[model samples]
Target chain A: MLDGFAGGFIEILQIATLMTMFVGVIAGIVASAIPGFTITMAIVLTLPLTFYMPPIQGIATMLGVYVGGLTGGMISAALLGIPGTPSAVATTFDAYPMARKGDPGRALGIGIFASFFGTLVSIIVLVLAAPPLAIVAIQLGPWEYFSLIVFAMTVIASLVGRSLVRGLIAGLIGIFLATIGPDPMMNSPRFTFDLAMLSSGLPFLAVLIGVYAVSQLLGEVEQMRSGSSKGEALIEERIVFRPLSYLMDTIRRPINLIRSSLVGVFIGAVPGAGGSIANLLAYDQARRASKDPDSFGTGVPEGVVASESGNSSTAGGGLIPMIALGIPGSAVDAVLMASLMVHGIAVGPRLMVDNPEIVYSIFVGLFIGALMMLLIALSSMRYFLMVTRIPKHIIVPIVLVFCAVGVFALNNRVTDIYLLFFVGALGYVMKKMDYPLAPLVLGVILGPIAETNLRRALSTSEDLTLFITRPVSAVLLGLAVISLVVFLRHRMRPRASADS
Target chain B: MSDPRSNNASGRPDRPEDDAAPQPEGISGDSGLLQFAFNLVMLAGFGYLFWEAMALPESRWEPLGAGTFPRVLLGALMLLNVIMLIQSAPQARAELGHGPRQLFGVAWRTMLEFRTVFTVLGAFGVFLILIRPLGFVIAAFLFAFGVQLLLGPRTWRNLVISAIIAAVATVGLQVFFAEALNVFLPRGPFS
Candidate 1:
């Protein structure tokens, strides 16, 4: 391992690989800073460019993009009060408030340092626990997978606005939408409704861009029309990035940082729970632990620290299962896996034995990528902060245009463009109706996996007891039940108080 | 992008009962009633989809047929809708307050309030329709330029900036995808 680690460092130290990694990281930051352009989307676009590079080099460069994109999301979330990526959703809760309150720099500073430390912690965990975790991950049956999704779905109750029923409705609608194409277990066309477009199911990218990005831009316009001052813009403070101070503060509150990072890593290791859930769950944990819990959503630095660290760490956490068990934890990880497969590098339990140098190099590359992201984000942050200075009207139209371009670029299908508008309209109505979009998006992403596993489990044995009989599956289901109960009880307490 | 922080805070919204419960939450009046009606329509749609799922061909080999999962989902969806219907029944009652004759008028007023949303959606719809025939670049430029021109006070300055941004953005994305990434974007008749 030591020899491979040394050799991998030598391998990555090559100038060409380093330069590409730098460029890829920069591009990721730029793309993810744009609202509606997700880290997954940026990685998808970057995949083709890496087709020509050698295996390790290509993977390293993409890794740069992945880590950079994760951090880049905080830029927009803090500055413009808009989450650049779904993972940064919680960052907006505090970062936006801080920025609007005239300290965008501090928000970004806290987020950046937190992201850096989070990545480091996840890397340490990844290096130490990946082999054993993969062994355990590979042991998960279809029952466990389904139960895992069930647990993940309970997070929707916390996320959905004031109404758990409305959230469930949104999530159910998402699951139904995902079921539109051929059945997962059987190739029989189930709900295509005889339309050619429905044959392949709705593209995930289009739905994400439509639901999150398009609806957001619309909200921006609505705000413009409602607010009296278009002149106020986003923020006007002379930005001051105090990285050392934020780092010190974060280190002082080691529990929040460690707990949030652990939440991210553990969630990331779980297939289907990626950064989206990680950030929120981490924030919720932080809120629950804080002495000043009420101060969270109102510009608390702890909230930003919890969210950014939680999300950034997921990159390494996601790689753990992928490198060890050959299962992808998220769509971006699936793409990363695909990139490796294209190079004929088989990923599984034997990956380390077969390519120790590659594994070691990837580990080293992660640290390098994280360090590079920190440097680039700090230097260019002033420039990124300048985006807030642009007037809303100008930003609005240009962003919408970018949305159109991005939608069309995915799948090269004009049908996707139509779907973007359709989903966008649905998102708008849902927004107006006080329904949460996150539940819907999560349901869409994880529904198929849940369905496939459920069917597989049922087919394997008609006995549904397999879910409960299995220790891990039972634990997960128990956890899901506990989560639902806690959420319900928590919600009822406030209502009962109001009623009395 | 969706600023869901306020929504996700999970604040306790007031719930209206069928009887003499004082107005509950942001959704107490006519809008709440409209939501109940919307749920009813959704219930009907889900019911229809459930019925349709019954007709899908089930493979003889698999123990669980393909339709089973969807049927399960539809059942859950239908149940959820019923709960929503129960919760918002008061709103539906309020809708009948001004007589059933004025329902259309109330809905029209609500729709009119979202004029900006509709107008923006209209421009997006036009862009979708135009993209295939006019190609991505032209459709994008037109949409950006048009939306920018209409959004706030339509200064010529806004027009110029929008125009430049639209053109530059459209061309840059097109060139980048085609030349650098080898992903060719569609070109219209002019190109």
Candidate 2:
């Protein structure tokens, strides 16, 4: 383990690797600080660019983006009172008020520090948890694996979107889309329809760029049409830098910081849940725990701490499932897994064994990324604030062009760009219809594994009853059932009360 | 625990219910009729795919055929589409009661409201088509410049700025990819 850590440090500390990571950090901050651009979009566009770099360096660069993006969101939330990303919604509750109170620098400084500590705590938990979890995960048979996927799909469907049925349908659509080209086992083409584009199957990267970047940009255009564009700065107050004082203030509420971070980690480990939920949940928890809970949204330091820490910690917590199991906890983690898979690196229980150096690099890279995020955010926040002012009209067209270029560069195939357009249109329709896109992306990633395991388990045993008779597999399936029932009840409760 | 933040110091109502309540499902008003129609289209597509899957060859070595998994998924999709169709029928009926002329007006207004989105989407389609013939640089340049002007204020200063941005993005991207990444983009006439 020590040697692995040392090797990882060596690989990541290279001048070229650090340079790209620095650039990635800047790109992430700039992208997320723009109101319409998401961290997922930033990472998705960054994917093709990383294809040219060595594996460790590429992954390291993305980690920088992930960490920087998490903190970058606080910039717009505090300065403009509009969340740059969904995860920063809670930050606006307090940080915006703080900025309004003529303490904009304090709000940003506390958030940056809280983010730094939160990442550190989550990384410690990740280091402690993932390896042992992988060891146990490696022992699971095909029955258990398939059952686990079933549970994951149900949980994801239940957690996301308003209607459980709609979420499930989106997931099913994704799995069906994955089934378009070839059958995993038989090498037989399933739904190619003799078209060359569908012959090799839809590229996952193209689907990602299309469903997220293009659709999201179109949504921004709609917002522009709706006349929500704030051409002038909302707050013109000068920011005062008092980083040391704010750092002390954030650290003074250690319990709140730690507890909120734990909430983030737990929520992030859950399939389909990510920073958006974590921030809110953590802030709620912090408010509940406070003796003077009434002060929560009134520029309280604890509020900023809890919200920023909560969202930032999810970066580490999200990595836990991706490292320990092959299953990604969220869409961002799915993209990370895709990046690794692009390098022909199989990401699963054996990942630590096959590429211990990569695992170690990840562990080290996250810590360094967090440190770098703190440094960059504290020093260059004014510039990030400037990014929030970029007009949606200009941003929309420019990003769309980037999406096209990135998708086309993925395989140097023009067909993929066409696929991106169709998928983007489909995604836009789904988004407008209120269907959540996360489960669909997860389903695409997990569909092949689910099918292969189901077949492999059945082939290994003629008795279909063994699936239920086996303890672990049965437990997983039982959990899936329970998850569905819980979601159904949760959805119906409010309507039932209203009827009464 | 009861959320104390619900009634915070900030006079702003911290209604957690806003996040908890699902946004009004699109299955209401005119959109409901559209949803019903969309569900019908999905049902047909899934049904056809299920039929196609039935013909997939089975392997003697494995109990599950190549088609089995996809068939199961398609079946679920068809079933869900049917459920959606059934759920939206009442709303669709209500929408239809508004009469064809009213419905036509609503649909026309919606198209007009989304005209910008549709226009940009159309430009994107054209760009994709042009990529093969005009090459990536020229196609991207035209698309970016055109869309920027269309979306932004139509002024001379904005036009010059948009043109410069379009050129930098296309040419700079082309050069970066070619020189640094060694990934040569399609050159077309330039090649």
Candidate 3:
């Protein structure tokens, strides 16, 4: 391992490799900072570009984009109250409010530091525990996956703001929305309503951009009309950059940072779940564990730290399965595996034995890439913050156009853009009614996964009791019940006290 | 075990002063009527979907079949919407106590209050419709320029700036995606 690391370090340190990695990181950051652009999209775009490079250099460059994209997502999430990627949704819960409260610099600074540390932690875990972790993850069956999703669904408890019923309704609506295109198990249509657009179903990206971005922009318009700042920028406060202090602020909550990163790593190691689930799960756990949980969504450093760290750690965690077992953890990992395959390098259990240099190069490259991302983010943060200075009237329309273009670019489908408009309107109405949107988005993401697993598990056996009999599934279900109970008890306590 | 955060969960003592305003009952006043109406529409929608799902072919191979999951979700949604309707019924009744003209007046005032949002949303809708016919650049430019003019100060300088921004964003984005990213946007006649 040491020899491999030494060899990898030398390869990555080559000026050509280092320069490409730097550019890849910048491209990743810029792509993910656009609301409709995703990390997967950025990596997919980078794939063909990397085909000409050496295997190690190509993988290293993609790794740069992976790490950079994770942190870049929080930039727009904090600045605009619109998550740049689905993974950054939890970041907006607090970071946007922090920015709105005149501390955009602090929010960005803390997020960058948290993301840096999170990558480091996940990399350490990946290096030390990859093989064993991949084996354990692969052992999980359909039952375990379904139960895990049920446990994830319990996070709606934390997101339900004032009313639990409304939150559940929103979440259920999202699940139903996911069921629109076609039934997961059988390709038979369930709710197409005979419309061509509905025939393909609502794209998750469109739902995300519409529910969050478009609704958010419309809300900004309403605020402009009502507030005194008719022609003013998003933030009028004088911005300050205090990177060192925010670093201390993030590190001071060492427990939250570590816990969130670990959550991210575990979720990323799971085959299907990725940073989108990790960010929310980490934020929920942080809130549940905090001394003052009520401050979670109110622009606290803890929320930003939890979310950014959680998502960033997934970059390292996602590489684990690909490196150890040749099983791609997510779409980005699949693209990386494809890049390696293009170089005639087989990626599987024998990968370390066959190409220890490549494995070690990846390890070292991640560390260097993370460091590069930190330097790039810190120095360029001031320019990104200039976004806050763009007047709302100008930024709103431009971003809306960007949103449309991004959605259109997703599949080059004009129908998807049309779906964005209607979804945006529904999201606006839902927002106006005080319904929490997070659970809805979460439901949409998890819905298909949950249904497919449930059906798969049942098809394997007619006995539903196997779900409880299986040790892992039982534990997961137990955890879900406990989570629901704790949330209920927490919610009821206030009303109980007021009555008393 | 008693959670430390529970004591302040509802009161949220740590919330910033600006956010400390009393939380509105989501089912009250004009908003209550809106919620009530929204729930009614949703209930009908869920009901219709549930019926549609019931007709989905049940696979003999798999026990659960295609429609089972959606049926389960739609059932839950219907139940939740019903619960929301019941909860909001009292406030909605009070709002309806006012005559039709009064209700109409309140609705008009609410619409006027959100006139800007409605206008922008309408313009966005038109932009989406025009994308295929007029192409991305032309449609996006028109939408951006028009919305900016409508929203921003409508002075001559602002109009020129809006026009410049609209042109740059639409054209620059098209070129960047096409040349750099290789994802071609719709060109319509420009194609």
TM-score of chain A, every prediction, order shown: 0.89, 0.62, 0.99
Top-scoring candidate (DockQ): 1
Candidate 1 TM-score, true structure as reference: 0.89
Query: Judged by TM-score, which candidate is best?
Result: 3
Colliding residue pairs in candidate 3: none
Which portions of model 2 miss their true places by more than 4 Å? Answer: A1-119, A122-131, A226-366, A465-475, B1-30
> What digit string (tens of lDDT, one per residue) describes model 3 on residues A350-450?
99998899999999999999999999999999999999999999999999999999998899888999999999998878776667788888899999899
Model 1: lDDT of residue A313: 88
Per-residue alpha-carbon lDDT of candidate 2 for residues A154-195, written as tens digits (9 for 90 to 100)? 635332444555667888998888988878888899899998
Which 10 consecutive positions of candidate 2 chain A have the poorest summed lDDT?
A227-236
Model 2 Cα shift for residue B152 (angstroms)? 1.3
Please, what are the lDDT tens digits per residue for candidate 2 over residues B63-156? 9989999999999999988888877676677777878887787778777778888999999999999988999899989999999888887789
Query: Which regions of candidate 3 deviate over 4 angstroms?
Result: B1-30
Candidate 2, pairs of clashing residues: none
Q: Please give the distance, in angstroms, between residue A408's alpha carbon in candidate 2 and its true position after superposition.
A: 1.5
RMSD of each: 3.6, 8.2, 3.8
Question: Which ten residues in a row are the worst by lDDT in model 3 chain A?
Answer: A160-169
